[model samples]
Target: MTYSLPRQLSSLLLATSILLWSCESFAPRPPPQRKVIVTGAAGRTGKLVFSSLLKQANFYPMGLVKSEKSAKKIIKDNAECGLENVWICDVTKLDSDNEGSLPNGIRGSDAMIICTSAVPKLRKRHLAKALLKAPINMLAGKKPLDFKTLQFYFAPGQHPEKVDYEGQIAQIDLAKKLGVSHVVLVSSMGGTNPDDFLNTLGKDKDGNGDGDILVWKRKAERYLVESGLQYTIIHPGHLKDTPGGLSELWLDVDDNIMMSPSHHMMSRCDVARLCVASLKVSGGQSSSFDCINIDVPEGTKSRPTEIALIEFLDAETTYDYSTDRKLDYSMNI
Candidate 1:
């Protein structure tokens, strides 16, 4: 009688366990997250992309910076991405001399977002000009964003040849070497016209003006296009530090947006969001287009989504910005 009671109890327990298990949905495990590398993640646009990646469940991004100083500031600004995620990587060093090599910490990355660029600082002479114009602008009921009239120059050793061309080509080769499936490159507008005002900013050792940053940028973009990897190349004009999604984002053919004053400039935040969105859009149409933000100073309720981006890409099937030879208005010297 005692053995019979024990056997009945064991059968009851097994039946209960089986019933509980059967109630489960039996959902399979989710797919693993993708690893993305953001070069120049310490910079304004790069940090936004890096932080945005942290929020997404599908991606794990690592920030590749140029120095410890950059790493610290980015980590401080980004509460979502900590120091652990940032890696010291100077793109200038990853040239032909090193065979397009990269630091080991960034290996096994599935994608790369190239936000690095040769930064231009406003000249002191323009600073005084802006200060003089600010009061007059305010009196005329206009925003004192005198940046259009301002002139800028790059720091030493931070030219287009060094950073835009050689450095970017190196990164692309490295990405290919590391088996990265996708690459998103952020290039600027005015590439078709080498005589644009920005070209005047480039100076030689003896102060001879002969550098055309857009030319170097075009070289890099051409290299990326020929790289044969799935890519999304964005050419944003006159980047502003405004909030994203609040403005109407517009995409158009090169230098065409410049014809419209409202659409000639865009928020950097929106561009960064697009960078993250590009990653989400697997099998996306690989093309180069110009983007800008327009209207809605009071803010818009419509946020940027992958669907809208995909639709735009699908509609503009076979779009290519690499072969445009039309030069727009020349920058007044």
Candidate 2:
């Protein structure tokens, strides 16, 4: 004998089965996570980058700090942003000798963003030490005593040549060894020209010129361009402390483009935003460009919508410097 349910009960049972099947078949899947290593993650800019990266559901950011104190602070400050993943490694001291000796923090990293810079106190002492260590005969490379040349030699880890240039090189070497794909370098806007106002600061003072920081930054830029790894070199103008994602961003590849005072400044938060965006745009391809804030006029009838970094990058002409002509001092941007 066949059993028959009441009409109302049978309808309810059939409806429940359909609802369960629909839910099982159409549930959203989580995005794939990608590991990204952030060097100098304890610094002002690095912290913003770390925080911004945390907001992306698919990104797992590992902060690389130079000291245990920094690691502790990062953990304390960003407990919600995966601070337990902070790593300790001095990028300045990373070299071929200790290639395989250090922990494999970079083993599975898909990309790296270098945000390290020498502290002011350390810079002053480092400059003096470099000046005293120079050989009188070869002080200026066969020329008379030129403070700028001395500034370059003594710069490793302490000055622009050392921290910005050499330190970045060490990170690149490690990335290559670990098979990391992309590297995003946070460089200054004046990297292509030593005469730019930003590079001229702290020059020829106390018989110790800082040796155009931009020169060393550009040197590192060139190395990354030639490292055969996908790269994005972001040259942000004078950084300010303003909140990010508020103003419009202006992007240009021409390093010599003369910018007005208002156009020559950007918030560190915005720079960090662009750095993370580059990783997702253009398939993580190599590109270099300058960014600055475009202020909205007060009482304007219509304000421009905040720009998306990926869209801006996609609209610009980005080239692979690795395949371009030999990168020399003459090359701009």
Candidate 3:
């Protein structure tokens, strides 16, 4: 073994340097963690969705709210959990509201779940006069409001069609701009069935009719489909605050009503569960299910369904919008 002393030393040093570099630079990267933005975090559904996301260690959930007050309310339940990553975001005014407004902590978020609805305080009269007046026409580039004495519309009142339609579409646009590829929207079950009691209100021209919420929802759903991002629309039935609530979810396209007595009404927890699960399914199908409650799951606790609903949502390549998708189950009280 004739080894040159200087050459052997140089080789040893080079090998040592390479080994150190490997330790510092060649380590495996952590899995891609999704940063979640949960809009309407102040609402009941948003709250539940936030809680479920928090349970998953990988997801860094950020609660997106309209006001600091709403941000505070969400954190009241479990201070540590709520305060972690709460962003102040109002979709109605996304441009100005979200400036430097993302939650302080967390990064690389995957998508946003919008859970808010029109404020209950804004009734038909206010919606007509304040939201749908001529001034809005100037801002929204729409024609004048076409209704006589907004007061005459009661029970099922008239709503601001343009405002809602535009606002929701704008929000979806903003989400895409933020590089969010997956969005989960919490819509209403009646949205699909225009003739159903729940959806009928939207068709009502006057207050006597069901109202205009459904039209807006339908528009939003279509926009989501065209938004070019992976999306899921969860249309839950009547929302209730029940103890140990567990509901069955049925996935379908069109307006077919399928209610099996075996499945009880769904709980907020289940809805939240489904929302999170949608993200896991491949091809974004797990992210776009049109879900509704009909029956209850008798023995289950407040757990989520393992079956990914997004698959069904994406499978409906056709545009037929008749028949209600039904879920049948009985609630275990």
Candidate 4:
């Protein structure tokens, strides 16, 4: 015999089922997590980047450091932030022959952000002495200094050519090998023009006509551009340690622009935000630009605008600024 409920009771049961199904359908689901590797995770900018990544719900950050000390420090600094993963690997020590031997921690990453830069410490006198002892390959050129052996003879700790240029190249090579989806480079302004004010900060220790630091950075940028990997290169103006997200941001793609007069500056926190934004907005696309903090009206606190990377990239030829006028914002690739 078929069992049947009362007509009114059956209608009430159906309404309850429909209400439960509707609630389930409207419930929010968690975002998918993506692994990101941050090089130079112990440095100022790197720390900021790591911290910001930690706050995001979908990004899982793994910091790549050069020593146990740095790893320990990062863990301690972010203990309250619940940061867990920290890998020790020196980018400068990587070589093509041993490319396959990269640390397991850096593997399986979906993206990478290179924030390493050499801290200038070598004096002019010491660099001159090292140059004297450097091996010369007359077949190469007038400046026959061998780049392979120059780092060993020069400042032992960190040099721009070794750290900024060679180290970045090694990271790029590793990213390619690992099949990372995108590589975001945290570069500085004034990389294209050697005569910019930042290039004038330190003396030319290598006796080369080009500015030592900026020239190497530009070389690394070019290598990344040619590597065919999806990349976003952000050239932040003079970095400040102020609070972030309070001021509007201006972006341009003209490389000749300079961050002068001390007022043109960006907070490291904002730079970190942009680095993370690049991964979210510019995935599978490549572009390079400069960023600075735009002044806000007094007593009016404004937040930075959220811009899609494609829109910014598409505006390449849409700039209507006068060529003769010198604006505070510009960027270039």
RMSD in Å for all candidates: 5.2, 8.7, 12.6, 10.8
Q: Which stretches of candidate 2 lie over 4 Å from their true place?
A: 1-28, 81-83, 96-99, 121-157, 201-203, 206-210, 261-263, 297-307, 318-333
What lDDT score goes with residue 32 in model 1?
Answer: 93
Off by over 4 Å in 4: 1-29, 80-84, 96-100, 122-157, 200-211, 259-262, 298-305, 308-311, 317-333
The model with the greatest TM-score is 1
Candidate 1: regions farther than 4 A off: 1-5, 8-26, 95-101, 125-151, 204-207, 261-263, 282-284, 296-303, 317-333
What TM-score does each of the candidates earn? 0.80, 0.72, 0.65, 0.71
List model 2 lDDT by residue over 1-333, tens digit each: 999999999999999999999998899878777889899898999999987787778888988888989888887887566444787878888874575655565678898899987543334565676656667647556533344533222333476667877888988898887778999999877655446644544455443555456766777888898889998888888789899877778777656434454558889998898888788764855788888888656764322222355665567676333422333443342
Worst 10 residues of 2 by lDDT: 148-157
Better of 2 and 3 by TM-score: 2
Regions of candidate 3 where Cα sits further than 4 Å from its true position: 1-30, 82-84, 96-108, 119-164, 199-210, 243-247, 258-264, 293-304, 308-333
Expressed as tens digits, the lDDT of each residue in 13-123 for candidate 3 is: 999999999998978878766888887777888888887787787777888777888777777765457456787755555542454643344245678787766532324
lDDT of candidates 1 onward, in order: 0.77, 0.73, 0.61, 0.74
Error of 1 at 122 (Å): 2.9
Report how far residue 180 has shifted in candidate 4, in Å.
Answer: 0.4
Kindly list the per-residue Cα lDDT of model 1 for residues 1-333, writing each as its tens digit. Answer: 344558789899999999888777575767798899999888888888888898887888988998899888877877777666888978767743464465766778899999989887777886887888888899999988655566667787887778898889988988888889899999987776666766656563343753677877877888888889988888888888988887767776566766775647878888898898888774746877778876654644554656657767877744454454332123221
Q: Give the C-alpha miss distance for residue 80 in model 3, angstroms.
A: 3.8
**Candidate 4: residue 296 Cα off by (Å):** 1.2
